[model samples]
Target: MPDLLVKLSWSLLCLAHLVPAAALLQPSLLVPLYDVDPASGAGLLLRHRAALFLAVALVCAYAALAPDGRRAAGLVVSVSVVGFLVLYVGAGAPAGALRTVALTDALLLPPLTVAVWSAWRA
Candidate 1:
């Protein structure tokens, strides 16, 4: 049951990263999902952000498959998400879709932390 929970947590992390990755990779595709202007400089920035998300997703997926590295992987994922949340909130409460994303990240922290703790104990 613990193993299943760990896998589920990691899977969720991968999915969390994947969403932004897909949106950033193709901003136009997210036009309906987010309020981003694909033609603007922000759109270009999102593309760059996509690369980062892809990296995180890869790490998460790898961790889920490789039990040995689950602890470190969970830590990395937790820290990254927490850091992003801090920055997002410090930036003065984002509006619209960004706010939703930030909230999602905030909510992910607890589960990610638990996953890391469990993996460490195991």
Candidate 2:
């Protein structure tokens, strides 16, 4: 059961990242994804951000499938999501499409805590 929780959480992390990663190929996705204009100067940087998210997703998927990889993967995945939420709230939790992203992160917290505890138990 503990192993299951760990794997499930990692898989969820991958799914969360994959959405943003899709913007690497489809820059127009930025509008719905983050309300940024793809034609703006920020396009390049945002695409790069997509790539990074893809890398995270790959690592998370691997961790879900490979027991030996979970610890390191957990560190990477947790820091990414938790770090974003911290920065978001610290930034005053400004309202916008990004707020939805923040909400998503908040929703993931419970499962993330469960996974962490389960991992510790195992």
Candidate 3:
């Protein structure tokens, strides 16, 4: 049988990433998502970020079902989440939606760890 925890974790990651990825097609989402105007440079960069997030989501969806791909998928997801949290904290941890973003990533850490551990044991 497939590992349930891996499936759940990767699936969650896929969905989480897809939310931001949608901003690629719908730039207006940036306003509600991060309060940035779509015409601004930050908005342009955030749109690019959305595309990158789509790539991660694709990888996660694939890995959720493919055992051989789990390690790489987990690494990619972990690095993305952890790197964002670290950078955000280092930047003095500003308030607002970004802090919510960081906290969301922080909350995912435990489940991610459990998934990786279960896979390793298997």
Candidate 4:
């Protein structure tokens, strides 16, 4: 069960990274998901942020496969998740499309945290 949880958690984290990476790589693809105006400035920002997300995703993929740095990777991911949540909430409640994103992040937090914990314990 512990192993399963760890794997599941790792997979979820990978997905978390992949989704944004895709959006960043092709902002047009995520038009419905984010429901934002496809302005040049916004697109540029998304692409810039996507680079960071890609880095995180690559690190997480490596951590999932390699035992040596799993803890560090988990820490990085956990911190980033928390930071995003904080910023999101602190900025005031999201509305419309972003509200959906906030909800998804809220739902993902528990499992992701648990996965990191279980992986560390194992």
Off by over 4 Å in 1: 30-34
lDDT of 3 at 35: 86
Higher-scoring candidate on lDDT, 2 or 4 = 2
Give TM-scores for every candidate, taking all chains together and pairing residue i with residue i.
0.84, 0.89, 0.91, 0.82
Single out the weakest 10-residue window by summed lDDT for candidate 2.
113-122
Model 3 lDDT tens row, 1-122: 34786688878888888988999999999998888998999999999999999998998898888878877877888888889999999999999879878888898787678656655666
Which ten contiguous residues of candidate 3 have the minimum total lDDT? 113-122
lDDT of 2 by residue, 22-80 (tens): 99999999999899888887877888999999998998899788867767777777887
> What is the C-alpha lDDT profile of model 4 across 5-116, one tens digit per residue?
6666777887787777887757785567666555667767767777787877777787767767678888877776777778889989778776776776777787678767
Backbone collision tally, model 2:
0
Best by TM-score: 3
| Sort by lDDT, top down from the best | 3, 2, 1, 4
Q: 2 or 3: which has the higher lDDT?
A: 3
Give the poorly placed runs of model 2, Cα more than 4 Å off.
none
Q: What C-alpha lDDT values do all the predictions have?
A: 0.79, 0.83, 0.85, 0.73
* Candidate with the larger TM-score of 1 and 4: 1
- Candidate 1: give its CA RMSD in angstroms: 2.1
Model 1 per-residue lDDT tens digits across residues 3-108: 7777888888988889888866577855654576778787777777777888888888988788888877887787779888888889998788878878889888
For model 1, what is the alpha-carbon lDDT of residue 47? 73
